[model samples]
Target: MHLHPQKSLYDLAQQHHLEGLTLPSLLALTKEQEGYSIDKAKRFLAFQGRINNEMLNHQVIIQNPYTAWFEQGDQNPAQIKAFIIQFSVFSNQFLIAQLHKMIHADTLESMHASKEILANEIGVRFQSGQQHENLNNQSSTEGSIDGSRFSFSAAHFEWLYIIAKKLGLSFAEIGQPKHGTHATLFFCNELIRLYGGDNYQISQAASYAVENWAAAGFWKQLIQGLQKYNDQTGLDLPLGFFIWHDKLEAQHAAHTQEELEELYFTQNLDEDAFIQNGNEMLAGVAAFWDGLEVQRQELATTH
Candidate 1:
């Protein structure tokens, strides 16, 4: 459903305040008011399962020739550079989508859920585990003024920046709109327009599709190619960005499931619209890979 255009972000934030209410308390209140239906929730889960299966088999990124070439350990400097620059366009704008999700969430529970994801995106970690300690030690360049550990090491985009720098990309080349190809720019715009847009359900659907897409092993494929490239070129590329995202996206599969369950339980969903928007978002993603493939072919012909 379309949210009121005039509602400021602050207004939406105010509306979702937990006010000392625990998750269970908020969920109970929502159920009491919304008249929770177990049967409906089950139906939604079934539909969601179909969508997840479809995403797994989606030939867009999964079967794209460019993806296959990269996975096969092909290393073309020009093509790889193009991929890095274009992907940075998407990476930098992702925060806007997360912000939109949090602000446009219909319920406090959903808002909190979105907030947690955003927190992770922005480098907020609740647990100071061994892995984090390793990250802190490894990211010496990101040390603060006093040489203390900073949270930027955990930030996803910061990791991307590190990857870009290792690949010989300048800051201006990574995220600048002018550096993005037509399909890459379209994909980035689509993320904000759908995933970060004011339509709460559509945004959720788009995000669900994206989470599933990420969990479908593309990151692993890219990492394999990148590792091979590093070995062949002796670049010693720090692949923490791809590696961390691969792990996180695996976890996001469960997170997306919970998000959908919460959405099913707490709000009335337009299932048809949700499905349609999700496919549309994936189409944009397909275009992105298609664009890269076109460029890869062009580079091949020149050689």
Candidate 2:
């Protein structure tokens, strides 16, 4: 894949005659938003750091039932089954579905698109790989460094399936599917679809805030819990979803921050827009974690 020099988003919008496109922006900032002030940006980034940590602190995944279960080395099959249901649905499938959608938007019609238009889209997958090292042997056009390989989302599903099978729970019995929190995450999904072709807009809110902050923290606790669950239960189930993310998502998140910071320095990012959407993204995810807590509490009361 040929890498092109970066172009201003303003210029790309002008060139594509897409300035009049009516997609609702997450940032809701004035179009005349000026270059980012490093001092202000640093402060806001720090604020995001605090908010991210706080959201994790509030998650039920980090609370008593899970903590008590892990500490006591509980192996109640019913308890393990209930936890897996919430874990698979809200944490794994929901998050991966959103990512798959965003990745599709980024990679669609990519062959004819300019590097400037497709850079971030490809960068996301490249840093993570196509989930297939085999792609490295293919031609550039067929399997470019940042091009599609195996479906990352499919891998997540496989993880869910393996866990369900190990616990002797059919896919149907994980737990009652809850929509209250997922509905909020679905809103974030719509945002990815809304900004489908605009990698800059989609990534600003979706990748940075959602993937880097929300998913990162959620997964950290989740992976640990699953490991402990595995030890106590002796299920030895495949947990590639957790393992895969635990290893690579941090690298992806860091790369995203560096890329965004570079964009800020180049006056390509709108400060107000990023901050507004970043906050929204974080809140949406925080609610997602809250939903997991609700599911846990429901299990507690019923069990």
Top candidate when judged by lDDT against the true structure: 1
Query: Which tens-of-lDDT digit does each residue in 175-234 have in candidate 1?
Result: 777878899888888988898788877887888778877877788889999999898888
The list of candidate 1 runs beyond 4 A from truth reads 1-38, 45-57, 122-132, 135-150, 301-303
Q: Cα lDDT of all candidates, in order?
A: 0.70, 0.48
Error of 2 at 154 (Å): 6.7
Question: What is the C-alpha RMSD, rounded to one decimal, of candidate 2?
Answer: 11.1
**What lDDT does candidate 2 reach at residue 214?**
37
Q: Write the per-residue lDDT of candidate 2 for residues 1-303, one digit (tens) a residue.
A: 214322344344455443421121101112323543434345445544553564334333244344444344343565556656655555443443445444555445433333322432222233333334331221112223345444433344455666788888786664234522464455445444432335565454545555555333455666677677678667776666565555556555545545554444444555556656665655555555455445555656443
* Residue 60 lDDT, candidate 2, scale 0-100: 38
Q: Give TM-scores for every candidate, taking all chains together and pairing residue i with residue i.
A: 0.76, 0.55
